[model samples]
Target: MRRNPLGRTGIEVSEFCLGTMTFGSQTPEDEAHAQMDRALEAGINFLDCAEMYPVNPVRAETVGLSEEIVGTWVARAGRRDAWVVATKHSGEGMRHVRGGAPITPDTIPVAVEGSLRRLKIDCIDLYQFHWPNRGSYHFRKNWRYDPSGQDRVETLAHMEDTLGALAREVERGTIRAFGLSNETAWGTAQWLRVAEAAGGPRAASIQNEYSLLARMADTDLAELCVNEDVGFLPFSPLAAGLLTGKYQGGAIPPGSRRSHVENLGGRITPRVFGAVAACHEVAGRFGLDPVQMALAWAARRPFVASAIFGATRLAQLEHALGAAEVVLSDELLAALDEVHRAHPMPY
Candidate 1:
């Protein structure tokens, strides 16, 4: 329930953010609403969603269903202002939206308008680019992630032009802050530079995959966040449910994320289960729920402003909420760090 500053935007958000990517796919509308209600009641005031959500098996037909569900909840409750809503603009490679077009100056207004209309909100508190148009190393693409062919001049020009478009949205009161997702330190710096030069919305946060199983953000990106004042929002703090120990012992429970996406988005690996077991052992030593332990560990990072987590059921959400108060002891943190050192980059 602790609130932290969202970058330098003067906006305070809860340490934990409820992710709604499963709303219309793995979860139905009524259940999604119930989960939201439970999260809010548990002091989670930040909600994160994206235009390309409900994404276990992303399809054109259900592209915007997640946003619509959130909008319906807001309309029915008449409390649009109760939560700090953050959503994304699909960057590139999403065929369902704009025919797989990369985000550009011409597409900003169109995407923003679509999100606003679907969410039934006048303005998005935090508008984020889903990913860099140039591509990123996230989602298990690091093995072949090569930036050698990127054109610097063209990238900078594109950033400046995009910032200009975002500036207009800010002036029109359509967005309060801007952010990046699945981006790198260099990419984030360019966005910040462009925003400063154009007097556009400054980059307020960066959402990236961070978890016990994924530590890519613990290096350069961690330093960038600490120095630049851009809040670090770690998505999948539980490693797409890998760190929760449910997928341990090769048991893929019915209706689990693994059952839907067999590899959990390529997170499944020979070393992953062993790492999960190591984490579970540490939690057992401290008599802690592994789910809460994993979440708390991510939230307790030096540069993290909020840790985004998702749940398909209300019971799972209730378990994750306990992480808000489960402060890990220094000894426990060291143990977790040891495990990370042993199984670094398992996926």
Candidate 2:
């Protein structure tokens, strides 16, 4: 696997990051362990997790179970030093985590302590804030998102506090780098501004939902990321398995995401089906697996440092990892671009 520098963090991670959001929910601990072993064997050193994960169903009881599973594997295999481990501190609205407390300088330490205790690691390679406290437009909520009401003073104050906490963690060796998730371009710029002025940690990356079906990152976000050297860690590069053509023609598999959430959180509209079918057609023309084609395309994006994807089964992980070696031709890339242009923002 080719490695890329994760922004200015001086940390090199694999082009493909193994996402562990399904560790305890769709995937059991044994399967998660096997998947980790297989990923490591495939030369994938970037492991991304969170404080509130295993979140397909996202129940109160199952929160943080994914981290525990990864912790067990890290403790048993003793490969903690071999891989770059990234995890997140949950923001408010998830009652199961820190009693739905808002992320602040005080709570930042508490969250880091909890994650360290669970993962049994001395330092998190990348400690990301899982969504902004002010609110985010991610997860299919861009339609109604209103950032106009955001208070700049309060938001910057919070950023300064959290950055101070992260600076302390960096000094204490509890975390090495910092990043963000579900953040807008403006929000990321503000963070960078505060970090530079206060001499705090700059966000090394931003994890968002980006795929052939979701091209929101192609505009301002891409420009900001490139100019600022903020690496892009795109989650759901497969669009929750929609681009793989497994759920084509409205045939939902028994254990698929569609079976749980009928539309996979507003991702399964009529327009989405057409976009997915177009991708499948392109894959056929190129004699490529749709899953591999999508993953490969995502990896080759300009500002994308790493693409994060989770697998519920060993076969799924193997199929996704196979894309690491599959190179897309110019014809395929052009065809994908055409499809993206036609069906941009399908959801």
Candidate 3:
């Protein structure tokens, strides 16, 4: 695994970040620990989690279970320094956490302390807002997304307020860097601008859904990240297994997330299968595993700092790690780009 700089925070992490969303949900603690051990063995020092993780249903009782699981591992292993631990403060719409409250200046301290206690760590390597309180266009909300209702003054005030709070956490030595998720380029710029002006943590990275099927980041978002030195941490780089062809022929594999979830993780696009077929065909022409190719394509993006991948099973995690060494050539990338052009905005 290759180490990449995590924005300008001076933190270097493996390009492959192990996502632990299923740590205490679909996966047992022992299995999750084993996966973490294997990840460390494979040179993956970065791990991504959220306070609202282990997310099959994200119930109130299970809200911090994922962090607790990782905390237990951290305590037992006593190797907290060996990993770049990243976690998030849940934003609006999460009723289980702080009554679905939006991220505000006042919520930062409570949230940070909770995460630190649950993770058994004095400081977090990267702390992120799960989503903006003002709302975001991500997660298939783009079709109905409208910014006309937003109050510019109120939004900028929120940005500055939150930045001040985040900087306080940094000063308190509770967080090393601040990041965003499910944010837009314009929103990102404002955060950067606010930090630059008021003296706070600049947005170090963004965690969003980017994959072969979702190429919204390829244009403006890509440019902003590359120029601003903000890292792109893409989750669901495989299109939630669509690019792997496991959902091909309209067949859901046994024990897959699709078999249980009604909406299959909120990816309900009519052109999805067509897009997957196109990608699989390209991978076949290149004689590459569709899974590895999908991951490698996402990880090799110019603005990507790390690609976050989750798994319910050890075998699945191992398969994803195999992409670490599978480098895509220029021709392969160009062919993939053609595939993207052919089936753009699948979701």
Writing each residue's lDDT as its tens digit, candidate 2 over 1-347 gives 98998999899999999999989988999999999999999999999999999877788998889999999998999888988999999988978888888898998889899899899899999999999999999988998998899899999999998899899999999999999999999999999999999977999999999999998999878999999999999999999989888888998999887787778988888898899999999898888888988998888798999999999999999989989988877888889999988888999
- Cand. 3 TM to true fold: 0.98
User: Highest TM-score, which number?
Assistant: 1
Q: After superposition, how far is residue 144 of candidate 3 from its true place, in Å?
A: 1.0
Candidate 3, 1-347: lDDT as tens digits = 89899989999989899999888988889999999999999999999999998886677889999999999999999999999999999988999999998999999999999999999999999999999888999878898999899999999999999999998999989999998999999999999998999889999999999998898998888999999999999998887777778887777777676776746666756788898989888889989988988998899899999999988899988888889988799999999889888888877
Query: Which parts of model 1 are misplaced by more than 4 Å?
Result: none
Taking all chains together, each candidate's TM-score versus the true structure is 0.99, 0.98, 0.98
Q: What lDDT does model 3 reach?
A: 0.90
Model 2 deviation from the true structure expressed as Cα RMSD, one decimal place: 1.0
Candidate 2's C-alpha runs over 4 A off are: none
Candidate-wise lDDT, in order: 0.92, 0.91, 0.90
Which pairs, if any, clash in model 2?
Answer: none
- The residue-level lDDT of candidate 2 at 203 comes to 96
Q: Candidate 3: worst 10 consecutive residues by lDDT?
A: 260-269
